[model samples]
Target: MPPKFGTSGLRGLVTELTDALVARHVRAFLAACPHGGALHVGRDLRASSPRIAAAVAAAARGVGVEVVDCGAVPTPALALASTGAGAAAVMVTGSHIPDDRNGLKFYTPSGEITKADEAAILAALDAEAAPAPAEGALREDAGCGARYVARYVEAFGTDALDGLRIGVYQHSSVARDMLVDLVERLGGTAVPIERAAGFVPVDTEAVAPETRAALPGWAAEHRLDAVISTDGDADRPMVADAAGRIVPGDVLGPLTARLLRAAIVATPVSSNTLVERMQPGFELRRTRIGSPYVIAAMAEALDADPAAAVVGYEANGGFLLGFEAPAPAGALAPLMTRDAVLPILAPLAAARAAGIGLEELAAALPARFTAADRLQEVPTDRSAALIAALTDDPEARAAFFDTGAAEAGLDLTDGLRLAFENGEVVHLRPSGNAPECRCYVEAASAERAEALLAAHLQRLRDRLG
Candidate 1:
């Protein structure tokens, strides 16, 4: 099957992401652009990434555009370097997907390409093939990574994390080393843990049970102030407190916004409702589930009030700053893309300022909790039909949920989100990049959320079976 744009970028199986196909997409992305400059390319540590990055770089060079290879760097780092240099970028990574799959994320000089831009690129791909010149040249740029690191170090001085002892779960994340170095440079004692020798897809949103079980033991062994990690490309963050309890991104995003003193916060509809309660002082904007939607909403908020301290985040904990906001260290420049480090650092700083531990800081947030899981290999058409059946027929919904109570409300912004009279929430959306059906549940307690998610996902599994 042909690759298609998902919530963030183009994704497909590794076998499908051939050199020719990647070259075609790269050419199409460039063809839709108004100007041509050196294209900055980066990749994750996925086994296929090196070859794919080479193919993309060769493709850019073939189109008469120079190629700057920012070897094996995080997606956000490449985006930052590209934005600063006024050049477009391409990241070869599958993100949290399995090793057999891979994807490409394209960025313009300003930031990530919008949904509209994806349409244009797809259109260009269908029109015609561009003639390739004898291959151009590819230049290796080792400084891009250093430049990205400097952004954080300069903003938050060397002692920003002076009193903290953080554990870095180095599970094959592209930013593993960078995270360790950054924490140490900020004066935190960075203890490396779970350093995997092979690629492991760690989903920040729906962490594996085995990994979750190991966290507390790891933290205890290291006597950590907090445990931090990221998805494969390091665009999404996963953090745990000293006790080893994971802090979901939705919660972290709002807390980070509060730390930055944001006047406006934008998040996806799928995020926890607690964000609304915790930060009642800020204007909260909820969009369909995706960074592009969040980014667009943030842009609108900033346009309305240029001086507004605006930021955006997703349920997966990827944070975006639309404009600079005041911090204890300095003003953070607008990255306008999902970043892992800022969210991880901002909360630590907040806890330090409050003279409390990360656990206490999390406990102080509203008491609502969220849990998510997915039924793998679920066909998209089947998932759509299941949702339509429940959405359209009250009896069907009652039967599926095994509850006689009527629905309190329904939200179809990006998926089917149902609010029961009992205050339970269930949101179901098909995976954007994989053959799966994702289920999200929120309730008054973590146990209840997990129970509901388990029940709903099992029901989905039964239906699919």
Candidate 2:
């Protein structure tokens, strides 16, 4: 597979996610998402979303799949509704990536399109014909607004956030409405961020320096207990603390697990710097990087034990938890999939359940800093050559010399990994979506870790140059 799909969905630039490709993948994925249930469609505010989502809806209707077109909603709402209704769904969102890019997210009746399902969709693409468009009856459900908001209020109850304020930095997240509504439902004031006209891409890969710098002031001015936000599709979060400091996802992940007091399924690249920080009672299981990897592991674990309490999958700041009834063991577990809503609702509710500030809840976890840098735009022609060389060529590994890897004299774990003596690590992989190469490094101090990242980026650019 040359990868027409990426970590979450079938993604490509606006130009590359052509109508032909859009129609084919959507048709194949719907076939694989099972049949005879309703099909819902939703999308973000991306420029290319309408075209792609329309393509998906057309394909679904062609297959006689009943369509519920919930236009311009966050990815989570679409997922929640589909899963709740026992129907499959498709969402058009490029997530936190730049606006120049867009993609389609296919949902099974349960949650996101899984890896096995993706492979099935790809395989079906070869055998299927181009779907003829359908002129199905269209029903618009504006009630997604009220229903999605109610899930939060019901989860935490209105009393939890009695006097807190939340700063919603809505650069381009589809969850902007939900976050503000969640604040009001929780009895907190929702202060929207300052205006920025036009399509200002709000990807975590490119979070503005001003946003990071302004967090403290935003919190103080608003008397906010925290600032909450999601990526464009509303699948992940970018959160800040009461003191007005941006909280990295890696830091929040383990804290979320500890707070939930549930079993954790995390990616291996996660901050092992947290192993000692957790409460001795919690169980931690590490899997590969993708959400499917974590989700699959959770399914398997839960299969063996019906009273399972898998908290969340946190590779970065946006961790997800599962909360359901029957209380795993006299205590409630969270939702099934990784939800952007969990970071806001679960954490807030967990803190309220404990009667403490989020800061104090965070403080229970051992403190350590982690940083990541992406070495981007490594031409497509060079990605395989780089992946091949980094893995098989000792001569190529020599090129990263003086980067923390070469300086520390380390070797592989997953991709070209370099683990430092100082509880830090640098991991390298060619981009799963783009031509760019990626280097994810985290260390004890932001300055030192970021400095090391800068050096490594320069080293690779120089070597690959």
* lDDT (10s digit) by residue, model 1, range 288-350: 988889988988887888887889999999999988777777888889999999999989977
Find the candidate with the highest TM-score and give its number.
Answer: 1
Q: Estimate the TM-score for candidate 2.
A: 0.88
Compared with the true structure, model 1 gives a TM-score of: 0.97
By summed lDDT, the worst window of 10 consecutive residues in model 2 runs over 325-334
**Candidate 2 at 323: error in angstroms?**
5.5
Off by over 4 Å in 1: 129-135, 402-405
In candidate 2 the C-alpha lDDT for residue 155 amounts to 54
Please estimate how well model 2 matches the true structure, expressed as its whole-model Cα lDDT. Answer: 0.68
Task: Judge candidate 2 at residue 61 and give its lDDT.
Answer: 75
Q: Give me the displacement of residue 375 in model 1, in angstroms.
A: 1.1
Q: lDDT of candidate 1?
A: 0.88
Residue 426 displacement in candidate 2 (angstroms): 0.9
Q: Which 10 residues in a row give candidate 1 its minimum summed lDDT?
A: 127-136
